[model samples]
Target: MITVVLPTRDSAARLVHVLPLLVPAAVDGLVKAVVFADAGSTDATLAIAEDSGARVVQAAGDAGARLSAGCAAARSAWILALGEDLVLPDAWRTPVEAHLAGGGGKPAFIAAPGPLGLAGRPLAVLASGEAVTAAGGFKAGGDPLKALLGRLRPRAVRLRI
Candidate 1:
C-alpha cells in the first residue's frame, strides 16, 4: 500500500483537475491514503480535499517543508508525492506495483517528454525509503538533489512511457 501526498496553497482549481485522477488509484487500493499539506489556503482547496476524504495537515512554509510534513504524516511504507497540476496515465499502476514488488531503493519519476507537455507526462512518483528519510531531514525549499545524494547513494528510476 502507498500514501499520496500533495502540497498545495490556494490550488483549488488545480485540485479539481488532479484529485479525480487520483480517486481511481485509491479505489484500486494502490493508494492507501491521500494527505494534503495545505499552506493557508483561503480558497476552496481545503473544502475540496476534505470532500475527497483526504487528510489535511496544516503546513506553513515553502514547498519543501509542506512536502516534508505531508510525507511525515503518511501511514504507508511507500509514499507518492505529486504536484497539484499533474495527472497520471491510465497504465501507471503497473510500473508502481512493479517497483514496489522489485524492492528497489531508488526513487522513481514518471517520464516526461519535455517541459511544454508536462500534463501529458505520467504523474506517479514512487518515493523510496531513502527519499522519504531525506524529505523529513530537509528544510523548506531545500535542494532535492542534496537529499537524493546526501544520506544515501542516488539512483533514479524513470517509468517508461
Candidate 2:
C-alpha cells in the first residue's frame, strides 16, 4: 500500500496537470492516495484538488509549517513527497516502483534527474542523492517529477546523440 502524499501551495496550474497521472487507487489491495495540502491558496487550488478526489488540507501560516502539516496527514508507509509541478510519465511509474521495492537495502532515495525546462526545451540535470535539508525547498527547481521523468524519457533532454 503506497500512499502518495502530494503537497501544494497556491499550485492550481501544477496540480491541474498532475492529478491525472496517478493511477490504480488501490492496486492489488494497496491504496495509493494523493493528499494535497493547500496553505491558504487564494486561487482555485483547493477547488481543483477537491474535484480530483484528492484529500485537501488548508493549513494556516508559514510554507514549511504547512508542509509539515501535510506530512502529518500522510497515510502511506512510503510517502513520496512530490511537488505540484511534477508528473511521472505513463511508462516510468511501474519501473520506478519496482526499483524502490528492490532497493536492496541501499539508500531508498533514488533520483533519476530532470530537465530544467518543460518536457522539451533544452535543459537537463543528471544526479543522485537527496538535496533537501531540514527546511523546505519546494520552489528550488527541486522537483522529483523532473528526476523521475528525466530517466523515464531521457531522449527528451536532446543532448544530440
Candidate 3:
C-alpha cells in the first residue's frame, strides 16, 4: 500500500480533479491513506480535504518541508508524493504496483505528459518509506524534491498516458 502526500496552497480546485482519480486505487487497497500538507491555504482546501477523509497537516517552510510533514504522517510503507495539479494517468497503478512488488529501494518518478515531461518539471515521486527516511526528509531550500530525486538516483516509471 502507498500513502499519497499532496502539498497544497489554495489547491482546492486542483484537488477536485486529482482526488477522484485515486478512488479506484484506494478502494482496491493500493492506497491506504492521503495526507494533505497545507501551507496555510486561505481557500476551501482544508475543508474539502477533511470532507474527503484526508488527514490535514499544517506545513510551514518550503515545498520540501511540506512534503516531509506529509510523508511523516503516512501510515503505508510506500509514499507517493505528487503535485496537486498533476493528475495521474489511468494506468499509473501498473508501474506503481510493479515498483512495490519488486522491492522498492531506490525511488522512482513518473514521467509527466506533454512537453513538461520528467525532464521539464517535477512530477510524482514514488519511494519506499525507508528511502524517504534515509534522505532525512527533503531539504529546506532550493529544489529539494529534485535534490532528493538526484540523490536517490531513481529509476523512471514510465506511464503510457
Candidate 4:
C-alpha cells in the first residue's frame, strides 16, 4: 500500500487529470491514500481534493516544505510523491504492485513520456516511508525530489508507464 503526496497550488485542472487514474488503484487497495500538500490555494483545489477523499495538508512554504509536511502526514509504509500534472497510464498499478510486492525499500521512479509517446524523464519518487524519512523528508529549498534522489541514489527501476 502507498500514500500519494501531491503538492498543489490552484491545481484543480491538473488534479482532474491525475486523480481519476488513482481511483481504480484505491479500489483495488493498492493506493492507501492521497495527500494534497497545498500552499494556500485560493481556488477549488482544496474542495476538489477533499471531495476526492484526499487529506488536505495546508503548508505555507515552498514545494519542498509542503512535500515534507505531506510526507510527514502519510499513514502508509510506502510513499509515492507525484507531480500534480503527471497523468499515469492505466497499467501503472501493475509495475507498482510488483515493486511493492518485491519488498519495497529502495526508491523507484516512473518516467513521464514526452510528446509523440517518446521515452521521457523520470518524474516521481516511490519508496518506503523509512527511506524518505531517513533522507530528511525533502529539503526546504531547491528541487526537493532531486535532492532526495541524490541522497538515496536508488537503483533505477524505470517503471514503464
Task: Give the Å error, residue 87, model 2.
Answer: 4.9
Question: Which of 3 and 4 is ahead in lDDT?
Answer: 4
Candidate 3 per-residue lDDT over residues 1-161, each given as its tens digit: 89999888898888888889888889999999999999999999999888989999999877788888899899998899885464566677887777777743557877555574434445688888888888676767876666777767635344343
Best by lDDT: 4
Worst 10 residues of 3 by lDDT: 152-161
TM-score leader: 4
| CA-only RMSD, every prediction | 3.8, 7.8, 2.5, 2.4
Query: Which consecutive 10 residues in model 4 have the weakest lDDT in total?
Result: 82-91
- Cα misplacement distance, residue 63 of candidate 3 (Å): 1.5
User: What order do candidates take by TM-score, descending?
Assistant: 4, 3, 1, 2
In model 2, where do residues sit more than 4 Å from their true spots?
Answer: 24-31, 61-63, 87-90, 104-161
Candidate 4 local distance difference test against the native: 0.81
Q: Which portions of model 1 miss their true places by more than 4 Å?
A: 84-91, 103-105, 115-124, 129-131, 134-138, 142-153
lDDT of 4 by residue, 38-125 (tens): 9999899999987999999999887788888999999999988875455566677888888877844568777778789765655678
Residue pairs with backbone atoms closer than 3 Å in model 3 (clashes): none
The TM-score, computed over Cα atoms with residue i paired to residue i, of candidate 1 is: 0.79
Instruction: Report residue 156 deviation for candidate 3 (angstroms).
Output: 6.7
